[model samples]
Target: METGAEVSGQAGLAPYPVVEEVSSLLNRPADEIDASVSLGERADFSTRVSELNAKSAAGDPAAFYGQQLLLSRIYGLVTQLPEGPTAEGSIVVQEVLRQLEQATIAAEDGMLESGILDAAPAEPTAFLSWLKKLAKEHRVYKHPYYREFIRDQATADDLRHYVIQESVVDGRFDDLLAMMQVGTSGAAKMEIAENFWDEMGNGDPSQVHTHLFNQIYEVFDISPDELERSLTANALLSGNLAVLLCRYRNLYAEAVGFLGMTEWLAPDRFVQVVHAWDRLGLPDIGIVYHKLHITVDSRHAAGWFHNVVVPAAESERMRRAIARGTLWRLNSSARYLDERMPELASHR
Candidate 1:
């Protein structure tokens, strides 16, 4: 089986004219190509996907086509995996394929009309209103599942599970922040760096975000050891993967857009959670994480939107990337919350 790196090299060497290239390479019937290609003797399909991903990151015109083809191949392969198409990773891949298809069509259309591609990006102030409206209708905000959870319908175990899963997701913020700094200069870099500084507790060892969160768990008498042992929900895992995908692919503006939207929406989503905790008589110290974010993240979101996302979004392609990234995050989060709601309700 070819490694992803190897397949990536091949993908760059020639444009795929048909699906048979992948089928022939994997020794699977062209019509029956499926996720099973990634298993057993053909297990190199995963590597091929990774290789195609690297090409996509390069921003070459052919890279998008390669990614579309590679993803389609992987889509087939994952569908045939032992766990089948409904598996967590498969679902993520399905969503990705849908997005990639849309992007591919948009990119082709934009290439034919240079005017649309070259039009000036929306100004930050104008963009903020659009973003706000997006947030207002975002599934994370409007979904009944999240509302129920926020209304204190969740059991203690469910709450603990949520906290631990979120910790796992939030722990990756450093990586996302670093990605945002790439190709940035002057005021943009400075603004992002400050956000990073705050996230890291402004150089204070004892006040790091992770440590503060740990303190919150301590206040609730939830054992840190148990938190570590807790399993992460698939939805959270996929959501994190989507963010990292943008980062790893060097989708800088898109990454900033996603992160900014997350920060902007944090307060609204978390305020309810904080109220629930307070009603339960959980100490203030246990809930400071959410409280602190309400103010800090709002400012951070504004800074990132104006400084990073706005400037980089100078083209239609970039604007679309930003929108895709934001929606990807929002939808994944909603799915995560929705999945957990059923489990939590079972406990009730």
Candidate 2:
């Protein structure tokens, strides 16, 4: 449970020369933020990224806003190494990530002010009811990506591109689940264990979820390097959000809400993807991943709701955190799915 301030060499997190005043960019007017921050083409973020991380820890929305790619990639580093940088570096890292999480959640909460989230229930069973209602009516389902994929209108290039975008988070799911179980116990732990076991392919390496997901990319010939390049900032934000919530124990309730939505979301989404695959004549092997998740994730979602989300909601503090986590997952995912549309169309 110890963390270190040092990043592993393979993590590609070498120190960039310190830059001053970079956090100011986050405060620029909304339209100007895009132009000023250089979301594309201007790659030199330097050590200002660290400064941003520090500021994010202080509850600055702009700070969380600017450093998602850095955050996401830092998490990728954690998964790649034999052990996470959780000693001294993790102490330093967790605080920064933890605060950044609050800032991000606060910002999203600000946006959803007076929205449907206001109706979340205080009691356990009622909260689950609220969560289900939110998931069912989530606007992301109406996403053009799903519509096209379900209707068989997506091209081979489109499906390939979609999966690559998905690799941003789905690829590291098992590791995330492991990080999630660190401080959990009793019923919650059991629920996560069940899901983790399924992810582990029920002790069969050949059937591991990550391996199954990779098979789709393997069929598409996306090298790890290619997968990295294919992901957009929005896509990385979703992944970053996952790592942020899971890496810190204070954020545990949020992690529960986040993963709850994820499990709940996947089955429906993957089912649509499968429809696209069969309709477009893609190989059965690539579609195999979706086919399996359509069943597994459905079961996982149900269990996660009952065992995890419900019990945790007993505390008002937990109720609030879980609400933030659920909305965070929903909103971050919507950002990725919505943005990828134009980005993918450009490739067609």
Candidate 3:
């Protein structure tokens, strides 16, 4: 839960990488932390660090931010914490994530500068069609990471690693869906509400998606200690970005796009994951989430396009926000898959 930046280096050999100029792989930031001076030494390091994100956009940029945001702390910081004075440490961490989010959108510098998502079709149905087409053809479906790191190529531990990393996002999905419901109404509200209901297992506590996800953790014997070690920079960013999009109202439309894209992406990916689970000989109880989602998400994606995206596309502002959110998900997801490959390679 404390996988984010605030405590990333707390028990590790170093503080989070100091905005390094080079990484072990190619030209990305270097993967070194500082133990001599912990990330807790915020005041000491504050002078050199940027008030904005060290990286610019969703891929590496978001991944770095994710390394800092502890999942346990973020829930309280973003939603439950009442109006009150906040610590400077919390302030700095939140600012970094905020800036990273802004930079993600600002990189496009407005949707119009990029492509049609910036300018949606006047007719909502046409816009809906475009979103579906985008989902069908997006580059992430073709990502090398997915190809190299799939069921047939996996070991049992490799399969567990995939599940553990994915749990970063899968673990918190219902809450994210709940966040999207704020200030929403009409078909969009109904759609999200229904989706959330499904996530809740339609009033069956035994069937709640989160409960279902926990089953895998149970099967893997993934204790609290193992969970943190299992998290990677890429997985962290993927989870953090989802939290960032859903927590703030200004990012609401972006959340719609992001969540919608997730619905679009999940079913197919889950299908493969089910294969991986089976191939790895994992227990049936551990894989209910993937098996269920293989069908559920397809239905959710269709309804999302019809009820949520189509209704929201009525306004230009909403259209662009949705586009950015969707693309942000795609970009971060691709980065996550790519970055996670090397982790899997070692397991193989």
Candidate 4:
């Protein structure tokens, strides 16, 4: 399969001023732009940068990022689009698909790290600009499944809780740290905690996650790259881990027993994800939580048990709120997968 790059590696890409236009349009600092370039690629990048500058002077502001990101997404869809019935076009389609896959992943990753995913609880001020960019792209180009995902999965409503939480952390980081404490030996008030591990524990939660991912992919017609770009999933898992840790740190300071005792007993839920991926032959795209948590979560969970739970949770009400939130997050994440899976599968 000949990708766009492969088809026009020498000639087509030569005139593309994406580098200059992107840097100037985004108003990115030279340092940031330089950070993205490889050591040996400076010369080529310099040439592209000059072209981008020239184009920027002539093109519409909304068109550049919108078109580029849209194109990036199309590059992904090109890979995932089913080869039509004709055999003659299959090779070309296949090549295009590969390019799309690479481009989508790169663009999505770039968006994620750039606080693009952090745009939830979106301000209309910020979102209007962003929407125009996306709208222009959709009008001028196709981005396969990512366009729909942005429209459907990432509505203003979906961002409410995340935005609230972001505000809490941003405004109260020092206060939260002050609330940390030691743990004690007392058991949890709810009987649910006694058997909670078993009830919620599906042996390996990664298996469940993998199943959910597969269900989502087949049902939603989501491409592998788009699935990888689902930063909402990343935030959910991160929020849970932080809450768990905050509680633990409070508990540990109070001399309450920490969860480290039980940490080893519970199954390695994330590791099982690697197993599931291998078994299913799924790409590593959707395994963001699995990859991040397999190691970092252990320390985080332990810290939470030792510090936040023991010290701050002075009443059953406080404990209840924390536990309820944990339960709600789990339930919501699961339900989202269940509901979306069937809908997505229909697209297949």
* Residue range 133-210, candidate 3, lDDT tens digits: 765666576454545567567777777778778876788789999887899878888988999999999999999999
Better of 2 and 4 by lDDT: 2
Report the C-alpha lDDT of model 1 over 1-348, residue by residue, as the tens digit: 122221332223344332234434333333344444345433344444444445544554344445544443444343224333232344334444445444543433333324422333376455556655666766566555546666567665656666766764464465467665877798779988999888888998776766677776676566645543343333323433434444445566566666777787776767777877776776677677778787888898878888777776665576766766666566556656666676753543
Report lDDT (CA) for all predictions. Answer: 0.56, 0.69, 0.66, 0.33
Q: Which stretches of candidate 1 lie over 4 Å from their true place?
A: 1-124, 217-233, 342-348
**CA RMSD for every model?**
12.9, 10.2, 8.4, 19.2
Better of 3 and 4 by lDDT: 3
Ranking by TM-score: 3, 2, 1, 4
> How well does candidate 4 score on lDDT at residue 160?
25
Clashes of 3: 11
Q: What TM-score, over all chains together, does every model reach?
A: 0.60, 0.76, 0.76, 0.25
In model 1, the clashing pairs are: 4-47, 34-76, 34-77, 35-76, 35-77, 35-78
What is the RMSD of candidate 2?
A: 10.2
Best by lDDT: 2
* Top-down lDDT ranking: 2, 3, 1, 4
Off by over 4 Å in 4: 1-268, 280-292, 340-348
Error of 3 at 329 (Å): 1.0
Give a tens-digit lDDT track for model 2, residues 137-228: 77664565686644467778888888887886788789889998997999999989989899999999999989989998878898877776
